[model samples]
Target: MQATQADFTVLFRLLSGVVVLPLAELARAFPDEKLDSDAEDAWQSWLERFAARVSAEAREPELRVAEMKAANPKYIPRNWILFEAYDAAERGDYAPIHGLLAMLSRPYDEQPEMEDAYFRQSPSWARSTGGLAFMS
Candidate 1:
């Protein structure tokens, strides 16, 4: 679907599913759709208003870091990560499993070493290759 200010405004209203995105990213997400200059200006204005609202809400002293952490998980177990861990276990190499557990143990903490390999989205190959796209 085309990305519009109304759609983004609705998404922002949800709060839980809201994601802060750049105008360029929004354009890229809906490459085929053309937005007029007025629409683009409206989107920027909406984003600014949304940001101000979020900032104002954040000023409340009752908001706690622990509460936010509890509400949101730092890591989500992806199918590709699990598949790799299982594959390694079958080959008598348990490091992958151990690494996964270690990373999950402190999900909120940044693991710079594992960020690229384990924390991000599944690689394109995982989606394109045979037997990797879906669970067996």
Candidate 2:
């Protein structure tokens, strides 16, 4: 529930070129009220610094993206997922539990089928709900 839409969007952008995150999209996701210019500049500078460090290593762009993707998981076992699994288990239907287990097995892979169900930011319902955060 702590995850924001912008956070997931940023991760997607980073997994792409990382240098191509649209300034307008970022500004919309994190408006001036949410993030001041100083904070924005600081983060922009941080990305630039990180890019410079990566440039120093001179790795292939594709290889760098692969490494980033390998290091960063596209999916995580969200609390709501576990809840759904457990609820299904309580109903004596084990398919959801099996699916959850299968999804968890490859947290970093781009399982596109599971994207809508699991990959994005926490749902609005989940944000106000407590205990969902208990799931890793």
Candidate 3:
């Protein structure tokens, strides 16, 4: 639920500058778990109210996203990443490790190129993957 909230919060702030993104759109956050209908409705109703209140007094969209990203990092070395890095290392490929290092070097910065590659939640398969360590 924490991950879902974080995803919703970021998206809320992202679209908050212009308009409130509907709760239906936040389904992307539920990668691992999907809320039941009652829970989903409750969250949606609550978030809609909250987003409405916030949007009424929001700053410019770009400025809002910039401030949020500046304060919160977009990248972190998650367990899945550690798994991938180590797996590559065991195969004598050190590039994943180097790439992980480079990505972590600017955790808070908006590395657009790394967005699809690194800036995302863990996939379902990650549940079975063991990692060496975690870093942020």
* lDDT agreement with native, every candidate: 0.56, 0.62, 0.63
Answer with 2 or 3, whichever has the higher TM-score.
3
lDDT of 1 by residue, 20-103 (tens): 445544442222334678777876787678656656674442353345445655455667778889999999999999999998
Give the distance in Å from residue 86's predicted Cα in candidate 3 to where it truly belongs.
Answer: 1.5
Models ranked on TM-score: 3, 2, 1
lDDT of 3 by residue, 19-127 (tens): 4666665554455436678768777887788667766765675676566667666677777777889999999999999988998998876677877666554666774
- CA lDDT, candidate 2, residue 29: 33
TM-score of 1: 0.54
- TM per model? 0.54, 0.64, 0.68
Best by TM-score: 3
The per-residue C-alpha lDDT of model 3 at residue 30 equals 59
lDDT: which is higher, 2 or 3? 3
Model 1, residue 1: distance off in Å is 10
Write candidate 2's Cα lDDT for 89-130 as tens digits.
Answer: 999999999988899898877787887677555565665678
